[model samples]
Target chain A: MSQNRWAQQTLWGWGRYPRVESLVARPERRKEVLDALADRQGDPVLAFGLGRCYGDAALLREGRVVLTRRLDRMLAFDPETGWLRCEAGVSLEEILHTFVPRGFFPPVVPGTQFVTVGGAIACDIHGKNHHVDGSFADHIRRVELLVADGRVVTCGPDEEPELFWATVGGMGLTGLILSCELQLARIDNPYIEMESIRVENLEQFFEVSAESGHFTHTVSWLDCVTTGKATGRGIFMRGRHAPAGTTGGLSLLSRLGRAAPALINFPVDGPDWMLNQATIKAFNEVYFRKHPKGQVNSIVHYEPFFFPLDAVRNWNRMYGNRGFLQYQFVVPPDPSHKAIRLVLEEITRSGLGSFLAVIKEFGERQHGGISFPAPGPMIALDFGIAGQPLFDLLDRLDRIVLDAGGRIYLGKDSRVPRHVFEQMFPELPKWKAVRDAWDPGHVFQSELGRRLGLSGGQR
Target chain B: MSVLILGATSRIAHELAHRYAENGQSVFVAARDADEAARVAADVGVRTEGTCASGRFDATDFAGHAAFLDSVRETVGPIEVAILAFGDMGDQHASEGDFEAARHVIDVNYTAAVSICELLAASMTERAAGSIVGIASVAGDRGRQSNYIYGSAKGAFALYLQGLRNRLFKSGVHVMTVKLGFVDTRMTYGLKTGIPIAAPDAVSRAIFDAQRGRSDVFYYPHFWRGIMSVVKAIPEAAFKRLSL
Candidate 1:
């Protein structure tokens, strides 16, 4: 390693808000990462992987951030069983590009494929198929973690389950994940038979989701600007892996098509008033009216079906230079649906509508102690960072979500109070106990962990 | 078909290794640091379908250069392209007062480079094929008061490359010297150069293009050629009087 390897850099999450300056060390090897951690630098350190989270979950602020991008490498792969072991820095896109043509795919993939495996595990990210396969942690077989004492330990569901569960969704505060073994799912082809249904309201969305339970993937786009009878009206999409021999010659074309880089990119942030209520309402109206009333069935590549937003690089720049905040929360699966209705009503009444609100149903919760997904209906909305009013509105929405037995996704959150966080995740104490046992000195710390009082005695 | 990159762990060299691998060329990466070399090898291997391997190599260890080349040849076959990218820009102020420091800089930048180049030149000459790319710096064009110690070493290395180029011209061997200006790399991390800095990606692309073209003493980014020409044209009396 060079004598002067650390460089001060400004970093932010994909949301692009709440930027912070940090001393970053890009270690190219496992030994370098270990040496940096053991050097007794006194500054709290966090392992950063691609910085795909929408908030400070991956940011350390004034602390040290060990960038793991250079450590990306495939350690081992079992072609027979489709089990792969790779460094934590390997990205989902890399994995897909290598294995998709070979008839295998990651079981759980979030909206974007640019995230690293470590970041996906840290967030325990859920995807369109969460209602069937659960979150990313469900497919993880084992993980090697570099703890505070510089000891590398192998943990899994049956081995060191406490530490494993805590580290899964621990926001990378427990330790730096060195590597992980994942169970990849075999697929016939890369194409998906997709069905899009235009729903009239929130109730119709629930009905459509329930009807599409047999489908491998399901998600709904919500028009948050619609009021009264048409509130939450939008398009519902369900997809299944295209049957064997259906794609034929098109499979190769699909693979090559997805490999092409995105052509449309938002080079700069739009004006502050670009995503205002008036503009969002107009967009939502046009989007809702654009889709046909009946169900539309089509065969498309999995990339477009699963990661549509990725087709337009830097899509978040549409929110403008001030950046935006992604407020995603999940409410318990209640028959009354009162909680979700109240939240949507509050958003519409605030006169601030997000053109990118998405609603999905989550299945049974995984084993991760702090995992975000549960048996619930979740909603994710993006709002421009317009100051106090936005915070106040989010606070009010948080109360309704809390009353309905819901918690916000930490990966997408930027501003939830400590008390609210504590209330939402009652298992925090258990996660803390496991973390303290692994890292007593609080060596592995981040701004999100600090903000939520998850750093134990150090905070 | 095969490329050998000495000092493969350096930011620019590492990127260049990946570029070659992605282009379907086999890569053999060697560096003084075994762990870093292995990491680069693994990264390049995973990113491309081409064969990749790595070995430990110390530029200052003259005796090890021949053995390193032999090992690479045995592992990945005769290297079609060999890149010399190892050098240190020592602390100029400290080198001015410390003879040992100055000697170390000279040895790394010039002496060690000469030893490796000689061994590589002999092996490639015997094969009657292959290209050698030396990553020299534009600082060698004209010495300045700020960093003459490092600049003088680069100057010597560039002159040596020019001589090697002339010797290898008739042997079917290509010798290309990459004269780089201000590059945004770890070596120039925080130093404000006042010049428009080129990214390592651009520099690596230029190096690849130079190797393919078999160009001798080409300036990276193309514009550096004009800039260095103007600097070299300045009279010594006038150049020494002004702070550059």
Candidate 2:
């Protein structure tokens, strides 16, 4: 390996290796990133956010990888409309910490807080409240995209709408998300008025989540190892931000001003062998016990309610060396919801029961043709790489997803088959048409783009 | 057979899991996060069965080491092979006045591995059929200013692994020591640019080769062996003058 390219050998995701050349840049401003893009005439360029998206979504092979963490800056926030504007490199944690105390919260937030807004927009991340609020893209009012050309272009629903939609879930293939204007939600308090319900199987989970959807936000944690009669057994969590006077009467200002402990390392990178069934089960049991069955508890903090896993620094290292894969997919609302059961069954039969299995209801039609979400039940599970079986099992899952008119989240995928992608995403040609319009040279690309034939020699 | 990888969640450990699972070997990954371990196991095609749980583990939880091993044994059954891949190198200068930093480096490297190996080595000795691999660094051979604090811990581990190998030589249990130079991992991400670094895949392959060949000690990159030998032979008085 060349001396300069050594760092590219591993990324934040499952140990997917990408061979990059000597050129690497950390652009503190959008101009630098765009200038670097212009400097390389033919070589593909990828904008690296917090490097949180699992897999090669941000990796550009033999090309330049632009680190955008330092480009963080908050431009504006309208309290009345809950509209906040900021640079792409600003993380969700920054937003929450800054605005949540000011009576505002991000419309959608993934499980982790380390991800950059650019990454969030690229992934169009959905959270437990996806059934209500949709994705990160849903809240985005406008985006300043640093296109293939050196010029910066503003895109939104009305202006360059196609580019805006494609760039939302485009996985950084279309262009770099330089800055974003997002519509946040007004919150009364920092803590969620949380409630937990135990679901016996897949049927109950769907029933509870649907019923809980009538309220606001809902999510479920399925026991993946539960087999036979108790298959898909787990807990369902439902919540809304507590009213200002409900609990300790904590104000939004107090919560926003509080700073989290300085990040030691990304929790996702914790050593591999840190957790096991007994310990996880115990932790899960405690977590469950903390919120008794149907007990309405008024929690008063954002950290535990939103990012509980963040408490332990470097938690991902717990997975040991094998690393982990996040398999997140959404199925359309079907007649029987058999697709969800089948996917769970497949995971069970494969004997790869993830420790954290999250099931949520997706409320919006997937934006960007090939993006992973639709109007159905979304299931996300964490899997550690045991070898080829994971690939084979995922292929089977892709087949199941495709057959059911479902799609895998490209942001979280590393081994999705090209055929499966082609079958699932019919909008590739249209997006390609728009992308080609912006720059026929195909300057912005990523490993995910290359792997699935979204960009490169074959395409 | 389920292989309980102690440090198996490292880059090399992850690669070993992938290679073994490709050949149909069952893997049990134990790490700090059960979710992450399960994820890795699934990704590598290994079933997260039995004691393949990821939760809080202090490799240097000396008093609890036996209990930890027993817990793993009870959950995952007999570990056919256990590879220790859990050492990290912190900044040497920063560790000078900080006892917590020094202790953390030691705990993660020598103390943690030794604690787990005590139980593993005992079982392997009894079974007379197992292999234990440790990824020690060539920096452990001779200390330097660059990373001597982390290097000292590895030095202790390397010596311990050598002793374990000598003890297990006739017991039919194999213990291999890997004198790794620098593998590009998160630990070395802060290193100055242009440093010679080995890729995770290359280091992983060397690990797999060493495990299969049943070698006691193998220098990764093989070239590191010659380079380290010459470096070690240099007079310390002169070596101290030049910044490493």
Candidate 3:
């Protein structure tokens, strides 16, 4: 039976590239979600969270996109155990707003809190605390997946382990995650005691990063545009959850009332030149110089420490109507952090400086399906779209990463060549095998999936 | 205080249930679909620091109103806030062709609404403390050929709410009528409107705030009040010729 539930609309990833006009259904309840999936009209169906994935990993051209945002609902929460059972559409912001006052937070959150809980698992997202806390999938106790045959299978570490691991970084290809049981981490207070240390050059960055490993969270903001005497200068910031009785902090109750901080919007799309090389370099210079020459200690709210950019609503518009591409890649730990240094040198030499460059270290590697974080140093940069030249630059960087035994984050990739992806992720066959077993029909698909040959029919 | 939301399947009503639940009030979500109601109740229950419950509630079942309400009061406490959010915009064209269709629209939007509300009014008047919010529509301001059937039903409901407010005034029971413009909901699913549609959550917040201020009636997206006033002032001769 045909249903008029699908509305024809245009969808784009957070990068705002490769926009697709697709038939989309925003389901407000579980039954509506099933109904939307069942009446696909012979088109492939993929469930979409908040469309926060920077690339086309969540987009599909002319296909059925089931929007899960409206399905948000918290089924249950055990405050004593820090266990939260919620529908997949619940955003991390909502979770933080509701739980932070109770002295609990998600085990790991990416740079933004706008992403849905399901999106975090789909990407196996990590935060500055990856050195200690790992990624989102590690804290998941169980997930209720709507598989190809339309059965809701309860999978986890013990039960359906293969399916559980596969779904962790499965990019929504394994199945539609309807809801899950997440293990939230307890906090003494809803604040972070942060310290920023100025580091000059790539050598200092790795040294400071290593020394700060014992800290709960650590990351660096790099001046990737600088060359010669000042190359790779940055400020390494580390923080831990503020201990109880920390002076000059609001009581937990007031902080909870102000959990959602007010935001100022980026009113209009900036001109292309707004983020051009010269402007970025100038901004980087001032940013790098603003921090004190020595270490400085401060106390901050979790919102600013973890999700700094989220403070400015629609900040992505600063990259203009075409938007910017966020390129993030990881290289395995090597002698003297050689791989990362070489990559940064190439980035600076290109003269197409990234607007925001951040570096973080991942702890001991964890085994799993296509999860991005491992034992390595990861760097993320945002560059304005400059057409073929930009793609060429990425292609050059791809070879360097491939040679260094590293890989580009699929979540941040919108234009990686198929061959490069194949070489970067040799474990694709294993992930595909699990997909075939669960979704032999290849009913679930995405634009990124088809672009990089991550589907059953492609090869 | 505990709140009861009838016809809670609608997005606005769900948001209303959510707001009350978050405020630490016991919420009862009742709808025509038992499973759907139970699911929403489970969802809303997590937000409340108190308690939440749900039961099957078909507004058209006038015969069962009292028993259903009594069971609800038993599950939750006395209903301090009652909102009637159920209505049918039965296709105007189809409604005109069949009396059953027309009656269905009128029965749910007008008759059934008054039935349960009177039951609520009776108890609220006795308790001498409560608030009732009736979700009417701005379409009720002036009837047009396109949707006069649904419009007229809503018009009667709004008029009924005004009278109810007067009767309950001496008893200190507050009554509020909300004339909503186009809300981002399933009801206005695919329609294109000149003005940006008000979000369901925003509309819910406005109604909640209005009820707190003891507003007898107000238009959602407040600008709708101005637009409706002009439409209401249009002469019947010219209004009849224009399709709305």
Please name the candidate that would achieve the greatest DockQ relative to the true structure: 3
Candidate 2 global lDDT: 0.73
Docking class of 2: incorrect
The better-scoring model by lDDT among 1 and 2 is 1
In what order do the candidates fall by TM-score, top score first?
Answer: 3, 1, 2
TM-score of predicted chain B versus true chain B for each candidate: 0.96, 0.89, 0.97
Candidate 2 per-residue lDDT over residues A34-88, each given as its tens digit: 6767666477888888877777788776777877775665655566788777778
Off by over 4 Å in 3: A1-4, A247-263, A456-459, B22-24, B96-99
Report clashes for each candidate as comma-separated counts: 0, 64, 0
Which residue segments of model 1 deviate by more than 4 Å? A1-4, A38-40, A243-263, A456-459, B22-24, B182-184, B190-202, B241-244
Error of 1 at B108 (Å): 2.7
Instruction: Supply candidate 1's per-residue lDDT for A421.
Output: 84
Candidate 2 lDDT over residue span B31-69, tens digit each: 654444554554454121122343345565678777777
Per-residue lDDT tens digits of candidate 1, residues A1-459? 335477888889988888988888777667778887866379888988988888888888768888887667776677799888889999999899888888889989999898999988889998999988988988998999998998899999888988889988888988999999998999888889989999999999999988888998999999999899998798999998887886733344334444654546677889989998998999998998899997998888888787777766788888888888899998889987999999999998888878699999988765546679878899999999988989999999999999988999999888899899888887888899889888888888887888888883334
Give the TM-scores of the predictions, in the order they appear. 0.92, 0.62, 0.94
Model 1 residue B223 CA deviation (Å) reads 2.4
Question: For model 1 chain A, where is the 10-residue window of minimal lDDT?
Answer: A248-257
